[model samples]
Target chain A: MSTTVDRPLRADARRNREKVLDAARGAFAETGLHAQIEDIARRAGVGVGTVYRHFPTKDALVAALAEAHFAHLADIVEAGARREGDAWEVFAATILDSAAPTAGDAALCEIIAGHPQAIEAAALGQERLKAATGALMGAAQRAGQMRDDATVQDVQAIMCGFGQVAAAQRAGAQMDWQRYLTIALDGLRAR
Target chain B: MSTTVDRPLRADARRNREKVLDAARGAFAETGLHAQIEDIARRAGVGVGTVYRHFPTKDALVAALAEAHFAHLADIVEAGARREGDAWEVFAATILDSAAPTAGDAALCEIIAGHPQAIEAAALGQERLKAATGALMGAAQRAGQMRDDATVQDVQAIMCGFGQVAAAQRAGAQMDWQRYLTIALDGLRAR
Candidate 1:
């Protein structure tokens, strides 16, 4: 939905919007949601007014960021869902692939988790991400590839917890995210 | 060592020490490490001097609390080590049992994670806990019960991550810790 939003903007306006999104992505990746909007505008080489006019609220900008990631995740999920092999294998790949991007950036993870104190535009991103994950997980459960007891929320919380672990790992905590992810995947299998 | 710290003290002095520990535990459990020394003393019905005399710093008090947890965890690990059956089973029991306690409390998990900005006393507790866990895991690995690639730190990180999932679940996230723990255990098993 976000990617298709178009109202026939001026050429300069479109360029400015693209610049703001790029700057915001880099800024959020570096310092998370706490990166000041002024810094993002400066990095974009645009006036703060230009940035604000493009996205009226910080959350709206965050939603834009989230929109990008979730869209990528959705693409991955759709691919996984389309796979012909074992449902569990497909689901496992989906989980690992879906989380890989957000786990690499604390800011991205923060935006994805929808920290109640931050990211006002989280609802749409949350919904989209939820649907993608659900589709994959639901397929697995229906095929008896995953534990019947497993819920989409369970996968989400595990993903979020790992995101924190990624941040901790960056902070010098020794951990291997992939190894742990494999373990989580194994755990999701039907008993 | 902390539990048996020997010193001559008047009965009221002993009472004050116990009271301070109680109040500090409650405060930290409720509000995390940010709970103030002044508040702890007031809650304990003791003078600030009494609290200060017992714990010269918040880190010291936090260390004392951490000491209790590690001691409990050590007991679990030692019990697992003493078990006669499969090493992995004993070790898994120990991991889940140990995490079950602190996972129920937010402050305890924060203390365990050794947040860079908080809980400075965590190092000693971490060291003790690590040593105990290492002994159990090392035995399991030596006996070919667990995957050789697994390390004590890996297990610790997973356990801490689960502590987070527990918190998230409390906040209404859907997840089954035991099920996930099973996956981690399976991952640790020898192929």
Candidate 2:
């Protein structure tokens, strides 16, 4: 019985790990960085012991949350940048899509805004973002699909604005956030 | 002696009220809406008694905070919208100016986001904002400065995005926030 318990527990631990990440992401999104890990465990349908085993501390969990989002963002950017679509279109679409309803986006953003460690991780994430945005901008400029004066920094700014719109949408405070992005995109397109 | 004392106290009360608002705005900007009222009083070089006496409650103080900002925003938008500058340019500039470093912008934002009461008060504020933004869009559309398809809803979305950029700037989390607003503005402008 003891041997059987140990073997099954390993599988349970793996399941709990994924569960913990999912719950932590949801809790952090709803309540920001200060969300209680205990609540996260409950949301994950796991015991506190399982949560602790999967993520020893909140910071570790936060790191994981941000890391997951960053990886996803990087993949999206890479894929989009390689596509034949207009560079700006692909870049803007990827950003808008990443910010769209996703499991961990809120959690990722909360961590970036409120946690030092997460911000540092986001710095690395930003580097990748910069590269992807740059590639898009360069392509668009070459294609005469974007203005020559635009910079990657400009793309970064748009992302910041996008975040604002996204936040308002989440809070149920506004419904036009996406429309504003479209308006701004119109301004950004080749003139 | 009693009359004399009352007169001086009334004058003192007025002075304290001004001080509390100033300090609260600064504190809110720095620490978000959670900045303590007592700290605000202390920063204003006044007693907590004076703060409570002048504003009665934190909700009252927060309402005053939102009201003041909304009024100011309305004024800027109205003034800018009425000006001879191109519609799109004025719109972009007005939104950008709001994001610039100011003494109380952050605090004002904090009071609105940190407290539910302040957010409720924001409806009136939003109405004012809509009016101002609508004026700008209307004029821009008339002048062929913006796309005919644009609506006030589009401006509202940009405003929400601008708010996020402003908050991130206040938190020092975003450096490119304003630039993105400019890029987005490009999309809103006429072809």
* Candidate 1 residue-wise lDDT, B1-191, digit = tens: 57987779989989999999999889887776679999999999988898989888887888888777767766776666677777777788888887788776667766554365443444565666778788788888999977788888678667756766665555455566666566656667776
lDDT of 2 by residue, B18-129 (tens): 8888998888778766789889989999888889888888778878877777777776777777778666678778867754543236655443323345757766766877
**Pairs of colliding residues, candidate 2:** A157-B180, A158-B180, A184-B184, A186-B187, A187-B186, A187-B187, B29-B107
Best by DockQ: 2
lDDT of 1 by residue, A1-191 (tens): 57776679999999999999999999988887789899999999999999999999987888778767767776777677777787777888877887788787768765444354343344555666678778778888999878787777767756755765666676677777777777756666775
- How far is B130's C-alpha from truth in model 1 (Å)? 2.6
RMSD of each: 5.2, 5.6
Positional deviation of A89 in candidate 1, in angstroms? 3.2
Residue A109 of model 2, lDDT score: 45
Worst 10 residues of 2 chain A by lDDT: A107-116
Model 2 spans > 4 angstroms off: A1-12, A47-53, A101-105, A109-116, A122-125, B1-9, B98-104, B109-119, B173-178
